[model samples]
Target: MSNLQAVLKQYWGYDQFRPVQEEAIRSVLEGNDTLLLLPTGGGKSICFQVPVMTMEGVCIVVTPLIALMKDQVEQLKRRDISAAAIHSGMNRHEIDITLDNCIHGQTKFLYVSPERLRTEIMIERTKQMKVCLLAVDEAHCISAWGYDFRPSYLLISEFRLLIPKVPVMALTATATEQVQIDIIDKLEMKPVRVFRQSFARANLSYSTFLEENKERKLLQILKNVPGTAIVYVRTRKRTKELADWLTKQGLRAAGYNAGLPFKERSDRQTAWLKNQVRVVVATNAFGMGIDKPDVRAVVHFDLPDNLEAYYQEAGRAGRDEKKAFAVALFNKIDLEDLAENVEKKYPAMDVLRRVYQSLANYYKIHVGGGEFSAYDFDIQNFTGTFGLIVNETHYALKLLEEEGFIQLSENFNNPARLHFEVDNRQLYDFQIRNPEFDTFVKLLLRIYGGELFTEYVRISESELAQIYFVPELEILKKLSFLKERGIADYEPRRDKPQLTFLTPRYDAALLPLNVFEIERRRERDRQKARAVIQYASNKNRCRTILLLEYFNEMDGKDCGVCDVCLKNKKNEPRPEIDEELGNQILHYLKSFGAVTPRALSQIFENVAEKPFLQTLRYLIDEEIINYDQVGKLTLNSKYHS
Candidate 1:
């Protein structure tokens, strides 16, 4: 075996590489700018990781996912490999220590978010490290045409210019031809070799069932498919409702979302991972860092907004190279809901400005103030006071964040803090005079030490409660009393999202709104929504083939086991098959998203109407074709030959 394979086997306990993994690794080791398009669970990390193990310097991995970074770093550390990550959630002291480790040759891998790349500290510290390679995960985010675009990704090209000699590899699980081309151009990659593995999932049976009774259908599917599964819902509320319903039905399930406390989220995830829970009903937040290989099913309780997200989420199953099912339950109302969601995602420019102005007023920041300041924001409180719809308000805040005016971090947790307002003598006098509070004060001093005197120190209320043999509420009450006595400045922990103003507030009317870009994004989003609608409403097309074609992989054959294929098999065979005529009909439908029978008949003008009509019926009866909601003919997507 080669040294790279040996290293992989030794560290990861793998004797072989997944398709395209070794080739991508070889390109990176040879110092080539490579673009890798592997599906989810395709082992994209090992492609750069193994090569970095072979190299002499630290590999800088740029990714936007903080949770994924922490997971990978922890995994590496467990394997005795040195790695570290820097993210926004960490304090300056922690970040400084991590960066120092990287600079002093104590770390081999440094994972950082793209937003941090622009920081002066990151740029300076990075200059001090001997960087071997640069790897950009989720590279599609760099493309404006891509589904999820982040302007901060544009900074990567600038960072690349600083380290011109370092070879860069961009990796993404889902990227279309347009997104692929845009990634290369935007990253300014020279002579980039793009390695695209087939987007087809052989082990995954993709099926979409349009049923009015979705809950019943969901229960049936869960009962039929017996293994670990994930039921994706649109909102946190839905997650809880569905998970509760599932649990009451005697299934081991739990709800997961960003709104849950950090400890609870971790516990639920651990339970699910350990098979203590069979299913996790969650929003999109629950699966990025998850690496379970035996997930037999992934059911979408609600339709995702785009095909890319659906494909990634479904791809999570069958990663162990075993047969699995990805089922999507939808109905007519879902299509309407998808349309409404699209509207909410891209609201009017004026509406966005109104929300921005309202947020500024709510924070009570004067114009030209609040720049570079972050505050705890309560979305429910803001919306209730303003009488705004929750969903629209969320979208508006997101748009503002995207436009670079401010940042909104959902489900943020600010730790409890305390700073001494008086010197040691005063604190000592108060402790002696008030003997009832002496033990708690001494415990705080012993635990946090001198940091509490200079600046705020994070303290765990639960820890304090345990030490003092008091309820958490009592601990809080005591802390409040200490603050009232001017012994210390104590701030309780806040478990809410934070919003930071990146720039000074401007007049609501003149908020520098980009009308052109907003309109462009709206049009693009409309197209995406239409694509998703087409996929869900489709009844005849092969689910796998349709998904592959959406990602620009057109040569894929049918999956042969989807709902359409099963229906075709059960129905009686057609009388006679006309190969040439069927090919023409399939070609026509493929060119247009969908077509009506009358329009299709007119296309074959020379052919007699009687024979053409008969042939169309034959294709329909044979299950090679089907009709959509409005009588538009579509190809039966389950044929696999």
Candidate 2:
């Protein structure tokens, strides 16, 4: 076996690589800048990971989402691979140790956010490390034409200058042709090798329905399609409401959103993955790093903002190559709301300036200060104090993030961590000198082991309290005392959302806001929103074909299972209906005096529509059955029994 295959088997326990995975890996191994475009659940990580494992030095992975970065790092560690991550909420001491590890060749993978790439410490430390590969996850974010653009991603080119000879691999699941070109140009990839998997899933069926009673339809769909499922709604409140309603109807379900406590979200997700919960009703925040392959259905309870978002979310199902369904249930109001969101997402420049000013005031940061300062931000408090609309303020913050003024991290739990500041000899001497603190110090060492000396270790105060037979507050007090006396560095658990200013606070009046660029982005958002609206409203073309064409794959065949394809098939003319089928339809009409077309269709539902409809039309033309003004079918007087 080859070295790459051997490493894959040893680490991943797989006999072979998935389609296009080995090609992408080989391109990177050959010292070529590679662009990999695989759909969601395509094992994009393995392409970069397996190659780096075969090499000598650590691979630097640049990603935008901190939660995903942490998850990937943990997953790598579980595989016995040394990995570390650096992000906004981490303290300087922690970042120092992590970067030091990379410099000494202790870490095999270093996952850092794009915003962290431009820091002076990161740059200097990276220059010291023996870097082998630079992997850019979600690479489309670097493109201005991409659906989700981040200005910080533009710094990656400058970062590339640090390790100029190391080959770069850019990975993204969804990117249009224009966005693809923009990424290569923005990242300054040299003579790149592009590997694109076709954007079609033969085993997954796509369907959309215009329903007035979406709840009833959702219930019917869940009943029809069994197995683990995910129902996506727009709001957090709706997630809970729909999940509770489904539970009362006898389906095991739970609600999930980012606002919940981290443990609760983790517990809920675990239950779903274990199939203890049949469905998880959630917002878009639920499916980032989750990889459950047997999700038989992913029902969109509300319209997504764009086809790119919808494609990625819906593609989460059927990773095991089994049959699955992606359904969208919407009404007229849903489309209007989706279109109106473009305006809400790109508020006026004055509102953007006001939000920036309010954020500065809320954080008590003076103008021309607060650069690189991170704070625990509560949107409710900020909006309430300033009398600002929450939704508009949110969009303004996002626009600001896109423009590179600040960074907003999703609400995540940063657990309490402890690192010993003193050597073991000093710690033991101090414990003996201060005998009152001896027992607590011994307990910390006994429970956590010696890793706390080398790096920050996550500690639970409640667990420590239970072991020591004291109140939790006592444990907290001891930890604070240790930090105060310089025995150890302690950071309490924090669960609030974080907002970090990327640059100095600017005066609201002269913020240098780019009006023309904002307008161009606003237009781009409207175009994307309209594309989504058209996809939901279209009735003639096949759903799968529409999606394929949207992604610049115009040669796709019609998937025969979508609602549109089935409807068209039913309406086609068939001249081959035999006499026996006509007689059966006539006999049924004779017994039932008058029946609606829908009722008749239901009675003959098992029969193929083309032949049955052709036989019915034959009978109608022959006057054997009366097709009436009320749109009911009845036997003629001469043929009535």
Candidate 3:
């Protein structure tokens, strides 16, 4: 075996390469700036880790997902691979210890968020260290045109400059050709080896169901796939609600979203990971750091505005080289709701101005006041207090954050959790008497070896429970026992928090009313959403073909497996709509005002050919005219014309 492969097997227990993982690792080992475009669930970590093992200095991996960073760090420590994670969750002392370890000890991997690099001390730490490589996970976030872009990622070039010779590996699961270029430009990578795997998961069956009763449809999909499952929703409340409802249907289910208290969230996640919970219904926030291998299906309860977000979230279903189902549940109304969300994501200038005004008012600062003021603004409550729409207000707040008006705090309430509460001896001792809890406790001890004796370790027990099922109480009791005996200390979990932009602390007048930036951001995001909508609604080829083509690969053929192929199999003829007649019918309705589709269809009946009739039927089918609960046509979403 190669030295890196030996290290991978010795530490991670994997004997062979995972497709492109070994190649990515070799690229990093060869001191090249490698851009790895693996699909979601492809092993992106080993690309940097194996290289770090072969190199001389610490690997600085900047990842935006806090849960992801903590998860990977814990995994490394479990394998006795010296690693540590630093993020906003850490206090001064925690930061001091972690940096001290990196500086003074044999730490191989240092995981962090891009936002954390803005600090003077963090930058100084990198400058002081003998850095081997800078691996930017989710590298697409650097692009403004990319889904989930963070402006803070722009500071990475400065980080690269701090340690000039370090080769940077930019890794992401999803990126369009445009996003790929933007990522390269933003990260300032050297002309690099770009390893892009085909953006196709042959194991995953893609199906989109157009049903108004989406909730019922989701339950039906669940019934078909019986193993570990994840149901992705857009909101935290919905995550819990769906889980709770599914559980009531006798399906051992639970919801995971940002709304759960920290301890409860960890406990629920741990349960899902252990197969104690059959299904996990969660918001997009839940899966970044989770790595359970047996998930049989992933169901999307709401349509994501863009495919990048969809691919990453849906891609979570299967990682064990097994069959998995990726089902998208949608109704015509979901498209409308999705459009509204995209609209709301980009704040209007008026709303942005109101937010600045409100923050100033909240802090009792005048136009030229409140410079560097740090406040945790809750979007729902904040908007409701001022009679502004929640979506509009939140969009405005995000704009402020992007413009450097404020530093947004995402989750201060649900602090990071760790499983390591004691060292090998103590944890080994605890597991001895608790023979009943042996496997669970040992898994905890093995996986989360870092920070077992320090302050409370933040952990997601769910991933650990992936190998064994145990109650949170069972894990907590051991932690509490250790704390009581002074073997380990534990802090119970609290909440998942949402933080907002840092307002002008005292310099209110200096806050730039940048209408240009806000509008530009809105346009960029909307254009992304428009592309996904256009692609999905196209009729010329297989739905899978369109998706593969979008990723810039040319050899893709009709998969003979997607919705379009199925329609073809059933002899569902392409409904030809007469554009001229359709336009005339719509125009006539607009001229007369508030006519039903039945009336419009009748008005054009004499002129209607088979195609025209089909077009008229398609219009009614699409609700170009509004459909009542009784199926009568009326006006909604747009004018008939």
Which structure among the candidates has the greatest lDDT? 2
RMSD of 2: 9.8
TM-score-better candidate, 2 vs 3: 2
Which regions of candidate 2 deviate over 4 angstroms?
A: 435-443, 569-641
lDDT of 2 by residue, 318-408 (tens): 9887779999999999999988888888888889899999999999999999988889888999999999998888899999999989988
- Worst 10-residue lDDT window for candidate 2 reads 620-629
| Worst 10 contiguous positions by lDDT, candidate 1 | 87-96
lDDT of 1 by residue, 443-513 (tens): 99999997576545668999999988889999999999988988887778767677877668988888997
Ranking under lDDT, best-scoring first? 2, 1, 3
| lDDT computed for candidate 1 | 0.84
lDDT of each: 0.84, 0.90, 0.73
TM-score of each: 0.77, 0.88, 0.74
Ranking the candidates on TM-score from highest down gives 2, 1, 3
Runs in model 1 lying further than 4 Å from the true structure: 361-373, 385-387, 411-495, 502-509, 569-641
Residue 97 alpha-carbon offset, candidate 3, angstroms? 2.7
